[model samples]
Target: MDIENMRAFITVAEHQSISHAAKELHQLQSNMTAKIKKIESEFNKELFYRKPRGMELNEEGKKLYAQFKKIVLLWEETRSMMNEDSPVLRLGLMVSKNPPNFDDAMKALYETYENLMVTIKTGSTPKIEEELVNGTIDIGFLVGKTDMNSLHYKKYGTEKLVLVGKNIDKPLEEILKHDNLIISSENCYYKKILDVLLEDHKAIRSDFVEIAALESMMNMCQLGMGVTLIPESDTARLGIRHYKVIDHSCCEIEKFISYRKNHKITGVEQQLMNRIVTAN
Candidate 1:
């Protein structure tokens, strides 16, 4: 079957509307309809049931959709691996949460493979997960637990979460009454964790000052602008004092280096992965 036709079919199946899929693919509706018809004819099966509002997949279409999605993922992986002229390794790192030595990993990758090109994107874990699923990034450095079974991960280690501020001697309740809660936006995974912690302590955040960069967050905390939560290990590196959160029962978060399971690991890719996973 033609890959383009299969792609159209997948798009139609996902949207359940030929017009919507056509718009997404930037193709005419008539062309999209013809492609779906050609695929159904080739398979000798009725893939979708025509409806007044939209198309709905039958059992046959559901089976084909599942198989074809895998085929598309595999094709993308193969093409990426074979691009030797510009061996770009795309990486997504969660900057809001402290990860283990991602800069060191990139440095090692560049040193080991001089010709390789590296592209790095920073965001929260969910953003990284989205990019990994769509094959936009080859690797992700994330903190916290992910239930995405399609991606395989190597755990770096678990670290304790602590509240850091310039005045480390302040009482926990006094610290909670402060105006500033320096952290990422509402959708951040770490933000969600902090929300639960705050609720358990019966503390209400007076203000949330959004900061994307970890270094900036630390700097803000040091200047006494606001206090932020960070890993205990990072506090030592930054020469700042960190106190354990009130509820010590659930304060640990896991760090990981993750990639799609379908992608084949090249020698250079393997080396990069090793550096990511083995590095402290």
Candidate 2:
């Protein structure tokens, strides 16, 4: 089967209209329709349901679409590798209070491959994992654990959690009792650890505030609006004053580097991974 035909099929499946796909691909609508028909004739299967609304993929088309996406990705990667002129790396990073030395790794990669193009996407661990599984990203750096069997993970390191507030002279219990606890989100990993710490100290806050941005969180903490639990490294970098290190084992969370299990790691990827591991 022609790669171009497969690409056309994928495009039509995505857009649900040959005309729209043709416009996006810069091809004539008739040419796009012919390509789709050619694919259907070759497979001897009706891949789409053509209604007045648009063309929708049937079950057979859905299955083939998934496989074709992987094939196209592999083909592109192989072609780039063969060229030996330029390579692209897509990275998915989870939001972290204390991130890994990914900058150093990226710098090393750039030095080694002058023409390398790097793309980065930042999100939650689940989002990163989803992108990795869908082949949208080449690698991911995330906190917490993953149960995805389609990907492989390696322990990068651990981040120490710390409690930061404006007033450190007061007792831990008094601080918790008087101030609100600021958190990035309800699902934040730090919130979970804070809950555990509260239970251990038998402390309860008057209220809690949710702020999404890290800089905003820091500013809130600085203003004495509330106390928050964050990575120790972040506290130092942000020049946060009055923070107590949480010594409990649970305070240190393991970080991991994740990638698709079947992904072909090129020399560039391997070099980047090596630098990251070594730095950690």
Candidate 3:
């Protein structure tokens, strides 16, 4: 019934190896074994079966895992809602991709709570999460489920990202002969996706721009200087249009907010988060 047992169970399910799970959970193998056993005993069900090679979930274990996952999510939500301060909420926003929604969210969050001191940190996920762990920032808007240990996640919205270019069409063969290719620096996650898209199409990237600022990239796109690809929703804010890669779609980055699973914040951050979401 304890959170420790569920934690151990989830880790083991992820790796399917007791030793690996123990390492991941930062506990000794024997200790994790004991915790798992205690939980199984309490529930009166077999959680995992030791095969000749490795551990596999039994029918009961699978059912338990499914239920436990939902339980943990709800438990964390309830815990967060219960603990909050009205004074201030330190927020970190990593710009994995610029958005039509994110800017609106930022503005609404800042304006809605007049008394709350909200410090906005803007950078890549790696940059923001470093601050999150170092106690400089309380929450981070990052991409996907990273291996930041014990971070609780809440998903917001998804914007479809595509490879884009100016005066470009669906058939890429005719377009490849042109000399211009747009790229932001490696700091942006969108840049990484663009690199792969270029390589896949056998397109030579003769032009490149390394703009670290999200606003700067949009400015560049609007000038008709060169073509750039960005999140579809994001492009509307800028003065340019975008086209999707019907032939080649490589990746979709998930946007999520992360905070320490143990550190609960209800009215402090959630109030602003809700305001921004409602405004959008």
lDDT of each: 0.74, 0.77, 0.63
Residue pairs clashing, model 2: none
Question: What is the clash count for each candidate, in the order shown?
Answer: 0, 0, 0
Decoy 1 TM-score against native: 0.62
User: Which structure is stronger by lDDT: 2 or 3?
Assistant: 2
lDDT of 3 by residue, 220-250 (tens): 5545444565666555555555565544545
Query: Which candidate has the highest lDDT of all?
Result: 2
Candidate 3 similarity to native, TM-score: 0.56
- Runs of candidate 3 with Cα error greater than 4 angstroms are 1-86, 96-114, 170-184, 202-207, 245-251, 276-280
Name the runs in model 1 displaced over 4 angstroms.
1-86, 96-101, 177-179, 242-247
Residue-level lDDT of model 1, residues 85-196, one tens digit each, is 5667788877754356557756755664467787778888888888898999888878875669788775667777788767656776676676377887666776777677
Which window of ten consecutive residues has the lowest lDDT sum in model 2? Answer: 93-102
Against the hidden reference, what TM-scores do the models get?
0.62, 0.63, 0.56
Measured by TM-score, the strongest candidate is: 2
Model 2 lDDT tens row, 1-280:
9988988998788778898788656699999999999989999999999989889999999998878866765565455567657677888876644245677667756765678988888777777898999989998877775569988776668888778877756776777667788887776667777777778889865366888798888888888777888777776678875787756887888888788878876656655664565466
Clashes in model 3: which pairs?
A: none
Candidate closer to the true structure by lDDT (higher is better), 1 or 2: 2
